[model samples]
Target chain A: MVDIPEHLLIKTAEARAKALGISVEQALAEMKGEAEPTTISKEPEVIDVKPIEVKEAPAPAAAVKADIPAEVDFAPETRVTQRLLTVVKAKPIQKPTSEPVDKVNTWPHLMLPEFISLMAMTAFLIFISAILQAPLLEEANPNITPNPAKAPWYFLGLQELLSYWDPQIAGVMIPLIIGVAAFMAIPYIDRNKDNKPSKRKYAIMLWTFFLAGAGTLSLIGILFRGPGWNWTYPWIDGVWFDDLLDWVHFE
Target chain B: MKNEKIKFRDRVKDISAGLGDSLKESSLWGSIFRPGSPFRKGYSDSPRNRSYVVMNNVLYHLHPVKVKRHAVRLSYTLCLGGLSFFTFIVLTITGIWLMFYFRPTEMAYVDIQSLQTSIAFGSLVRNMHRWAAHIMVIVVFLHMSRVFYHGAYKAPREFNWVIGVILLLLTLLLSFTGYLLPWDQLAIWAVTVGGNMASYTPVIGAQVKFALFAGLEATEATLLRFYVLHVLFLPFIIVIFMAIHFWRVRKDGGISGPL
Candidate 1:
């Protein structure tokens, strides 16, 4: 209703905007009655114009609902673009899937470990040879048999068995049966398809029994049996046991 | 002048290149050898090239193109089979060296004595051979136990288990025969006890003993028999079965892992 000069009108608008401490856009919006005038908060209002694209997280469904128009006219292009956005927002972002599950390369993986292990074993054997000396006794005299003249350490188990049972059974038949039943015929006898030891308890127990039995027999024959194949605790006699102590002797 | 410098560099390059090219082009070598092994140009970390590397080499062909990660684990296998093979290799080398100075006569004892006392590094080699043999026996038995405990003897691996048992028997026989080669009193009596076990067979008891001893007792003939068996016959048998054993390991789906 009142006419004001252009310069004065512009100055008044500027003064009002300064007094309100609002942006020109907010001031203009308030003048046009599009927005309500309010007191200024302690912190200045900040607005981001561009949408932030998050690579990891999918847009929440609620955010999508706020963005999309509540009702849409049947305009093909608008509907199609909205549908594409919805589709794009639906998928949760994922990191790229890593290496395939089966069929790994063996050149470096398998052979490298084998090479390292072999070298280590070779070094061990060389080191052992450096420290230990081979045993060679007096020439083979037909008459003088050493007391406790025993078989090789491996056959010691059989000899120990010979002490308990008939030589035929101990040396020949039992070994033969064991070789056939345990080693050769194991798969046939243990028809269980499971590879887990817990599942094949009986088979594992039988195997453990035989292994413990053989190991015990060999240890007994090698150490416990002394002169004339008689049982003597070499530790008590203090000859070979003394030698063992000397071998392990620390300064 | 620059041309001459470039020419010299080219010549050096050509010479190095020719070394490999000549090897590749030569009929005998070329036919036996294949290119693109692990370090070669075509080699890569891809599954195809890895498989080619295995399938292309004779020695490596014993392994499968691909193996389960668990199969090759140290905790699982403890590498007892590989250690047994390694010990066998050591024994063969030392055994051959010992054979050069050894004679299968009454002089056998003297030769062994000299081997321990006089020969260059003879005692060291002999000690290694002896220890390796002993270790091999224990390792093999442990390997058998490992196989059993792992349930590796199931189904497709049954025949390999049988071969393993035969190898075990051969290993013991080999040690027993070599035990007598020392010709000491210990050797004589131990072998006598071992040989006497053969006489316990029900039907062919005496014949078996006679066959082993070549007479009523272990004589010079028996010495020669064991020598021949130890050095030649048993070794040959072991090599044959060992190749089969290794081959079967791959064919039966590498070493067994979890079910």
Candidate 2:
């Protein structure tokens, strides 16, 4: 037979304590008391009867056939049993079980109509495109200059900027520098770990100011500035609206 | 027999305990496959958690979950701001299609005439390409403005902002090059004035002009060079920067947050 090591015995005691949903320290203390009966008798006032019953019950069953003297151990068991009987008699009785009933469904499932409408609108657009036969333009005319050799409408804003400063600086360099500076500083400027938009005040203010300035400048340039370096005063050349009206009349 | 049964029972218990320990040691389920299992519960499961499952998921990694949603919506004006990019695509396709029927020599003027009259929808294609190029420039500017307004140019994203600025320049370069391809008198004078501006760039102005015109004046070589730059070089460069711009957004915790 293999001898159980001291460490294994401790581990087994701990495992048993955990299985019974009790603390290992409590189990160990009770086991120590069992090893020395005189120690328990000397401090009988301090001894916990509940833990003693739990620990002693499992041990006596294992020790009964091992020829341990019954006189020393029978006293504690008898005292524990008498206390448990009195406690059980003092408790109120629990009621017996009743019959089971079937569960009734209270909630109904809901269907979404918004999703159906979206699908219908998408199908309608597709159908309309198929029915209308719009012709693509003629071959590319590299030679024939259209009457108004206009830059795309969006560039009209930047082209307007070109009217105020050098093309290299105003149209290109300033924009480039600003873009670079802004991109690099984003992480550092908004370092707060907050994800909510309302929490980030400075970042919002910065964006708003940037948008207003760029939009206003670009819009003003597009509306007021004409082609090339011709910075004719509105009083001399007439307002842009008058010029547009005159052009319309000529056409 | 009783001794043998006791020995077998002990061996089984030991083996079961050893297996349980090995399972815990190897982290068979937690480490091998279960995502973010070892970490604290809510911390790993939060949608904004960048380090956990996002590090492993192939597609989710492409986009940051906790983006400055307001910034992106306002920045590019949602993908309708992508209309400019779409217009660029349109121009490229139409430009290449036009090249099939048109030539770059002094004969380019007559070739353009033949293309309009002979080729089906040829004039329409040219008009669309021209209009689209104009639209693209406008859209790109708007897109840039959107980016700026959102403060997307600040830190970490600064390089992408620079890339965007370069892309804006490339857009203008594309426009300038395409301007000369028409081979008209207007194209001639415009290019001449533009080329002269290149010559006014202080030192090496003449050299820059020479490089741009490919000679003393805007000739066949100039047209070819402009065509290549407009269609080939600029597009290639812009695409590279555009990819970097998008990837950086994912890296920099998605668009700048609201102030």
Candidate 3:
């Protein structure tokens, strides 16, 4: 007989004892082959006779009078009970082996691309550094503020929004509510399991709208707005933004 | 014993070759370079050695011994996330160099002037730091969009996406705080515009503006506060989140999607 887990053995034994109207120890002993299974000896006190082989035939209700025992006993051989099943060889809880994916060593495969990219970035950064000097204007004087002062490029979108709407709506609420909170909650909000772009048209469209809006606003804020946050073409009015004073050349 | 008037050049060559071989064959050298490391003696181009190359090295261990072939394709990821991280490292190096000269005070402007004029390679380093900060912001945003489009943020990777957003916020914070370090008119006025927006925040508007400026308006104290946050606090917090993010990526079954 196969060895069962101790807890499972105990549980099975308890279940059998309850069904057979016997002690749990007796059931456990019988299950472990330490003793013969207990047989049911108590017969029904009185009942109308019926052939055992006629299990499928229904008896006439007018002639029947039920006389089953009050204790609710059943025989081990006749009643359903836990039986020893075949043992399975011990194996890993997870699939013992995995299907191999088309893969290559990280050393040269991943590392080389990573190295090339880092080098390219370094080269690009150095080239930009040499060409366009970082604009460092005169010392910070709170007394004389630059005309149409602007936030960093990234915040130019919000700055542009501040021009159209109240600062409460554009500057504070939108950025906090939509920019941070909504952005962080995207994975949770977008319940679509399918990752293919064709299947997720709505998400793509929504994101595209955001991109277009942000890009237009920032571009307008950067080049189209001049003194007093009023609209002015960059070509007409000298570039008002001082951060990119070096990048914008007008000879 | 066989040397019958060996030439001086040949003798030198023989001794050096022996020294090089002995060094590589030594136990100390073997211990320094682990098995499968190219630096070690008897290193060979073998599949097991390739696995060991990544598994043994601390830096290389960030990646698995082998990755899905699709992962290495530059077009797939555009390398935005890695570039974001690289830009951060570049910023950190340049920022540290700048720290030796810069001080967040009334004299900050003067310090910057001298840093550009007097210090060796100061202007170049400062320029790199400034540009890298801009690059980091752009790249980080791009990384997010890439993740979104690829649907790399689905199921097991959802929380990583959230952490990424947090990282993005931290990156912006880092850039914003660093913006004021030069104490130039551009820096001050730009920050003032940003600060003014914060003042528009409801309920605790004045309080938020006050805390940000260290007073009713931007002052030397505000510069110092931004300096500390830009240099120390924000980086520290971001690093912790980054560790968790990277760890969760591996735990979430490495990169998601062949689609």
Candidate 4:
């Protein structure tokens, strides 16, 4: 048997003490089987059982008629009686019902990895900042719109969609309805309780398909699309995306 | 005579040890660090103390006392979520530093040029901010994908996934708003093309576009608008959603599964 936690032991001891009208120390000792159980003295108190019966009637229940020949003898011959006392909710012995989990203290186990990752990220960020200067083109001139002006890289896929479909659907509706709403609704829609990758093949396939499509479109938008949003092979045309000019120039 | 015989180093060590004992017994020190703190005088390596190490501290309370053994495995989570949050903190620090030198008017361009040229650590900070922002978008998206693949969003965790999606959108908006702050040709034109998409919204298209641009087109007003949204408004909102998102993660039974 597992040793009871100190806090739980105290709680049970308190409950037992209150029920038996004994000191908590005595209750604990009784629970440990070191002391005898506290017995109630029956002389001082009267038990009020709701069922109407005569007082001290020499066990009238045991004197029932036995003259009926059709039926065999019933019940016990002894004049037995029982009475209720204070209701004690605590069990006689502590039982740990929950399965013991495989767990470790989170202080050193989880935090060490988190701290190391943070340090690595900081080093990586500083390294990139030193090498690749963030592009800052000339001042804003509304009159001179850069040919093939592009959105930020994340939205570049939507811009690519705009070339194939109407702007209302590609730019507005698809991102709002499909991108935001559908993405949010994934967990609710996928009712599969099993989390194993092999068991969730359909979801994996759908996401992979989306990943491939989105990746291809965004890559094309970021690298292949030249002046006038026309397709150009990045290797021959030289990449037109100014956002990545530092990295491209480095290459 | 005995003091004269003792080494100078030994006397200093004895005095310092007495001071340490006195400080530990002081009421102020006792009040500051709780019982479970490693800094506490009587702290010892015990199961109860280990649990208290996390539960008793303000920062450590963000985590539970113990976690499923597998959750601590670095390969399981890839630490993408933590990296995303850390990148945000980095951007926030660097962004604030950039703000000290940057003016959000037409002078924004001149300010940036001088920042890269004259100011100490200016160009590097700006580069950190920009690259971190870009990295944040990718990291946040990857975190979501990681959650999905783990099916961490199932059953009781479904609502947290929705919150995660909202956080991702907020991240994108935060990045997009910051893009226009430099008031450069690259900044304004990219924003213009993106804002043009807002004009295609079904009914309130024109209103939304006008509201976003703060005029018929990108102007000084639009720059001011983006600056406020970038620095103040969006961050305030995102932090609230992020709080709920993180709280929900703990409430939904930590990270997902062994599988």
> For all candidates, what are the clash counts?
0, 31, 0, 0
DockQ, all models: 0.28, 0.05, 0.36, 0.39
Q: Tens digit of lDDT per residue, candidate 1, span A1-251?
A: 56657677566667888888767667766765688975666553344344444453356765766666868432333211122222356655985687443544566457667767878877877777778765555666656766766777787788899998997798788877875565677778878888987798988888778878988998888778877678877557533221132243222
Q: Best candidate, TM-score-wise?
A: 3
Candidate 2 has an lDDT of 0.56
Q: Give lDDT tens digits, candidate 3, residues B87-155.
A: 989998999889999889998999999988999998899889899899999999999888888899999
* Pairs that collide, model 3: none
Top-scoring candidate (DockQ): 4
Tell me the lDDT of model 3 at A98: 71
Pairwise lDDT winner, candidates 1 and 3:
3
Question: How accurate locally is residue A246 in candidate 1, as Cα lDDT from 0 to 100?
Answer: 21
Report candidate 2's interface RMSD in Å. 12.8
The docking quality of candidate 2, as DockQ, is 0.05
- Tens-digit per-residue lDDT, A1-251, candidate 4: 78989889889999999988999999999888899989977564444445434354356544553344536533324443555566888775778887676898886678768888999999999999999999999889999988889999999999999999999999999999999999999998999999999999999999989999999999989988989999988878778787787888523
Q: Of the candidates numbered 2 and 4, which has the greater lDDT value?
A: 4
Give the lDDT of residue A108 in candidate 3.
Answer: 68
lDDT tens readout by residue for model 3, A1-251: 67789999999999999999999999999998899989888654443344244233266642442464446533222433344456788986788477778887776677778989999999999999888789899999899978889998899989999988998999899999999999989999999999999999999899889988999999999888989999998887777777788888742
Name the weakest run of 10 consecutive residues (lDDT summed) in model 3 chain A: A73-82
In candidate 1, how many Å is residue A199 off? 0.8
TM-score, candidate 4, is: 0.76
Worst 10 residues of 2 chain B by lDDT: B37-46
**lDDT at B61 for candidate 1?**
71
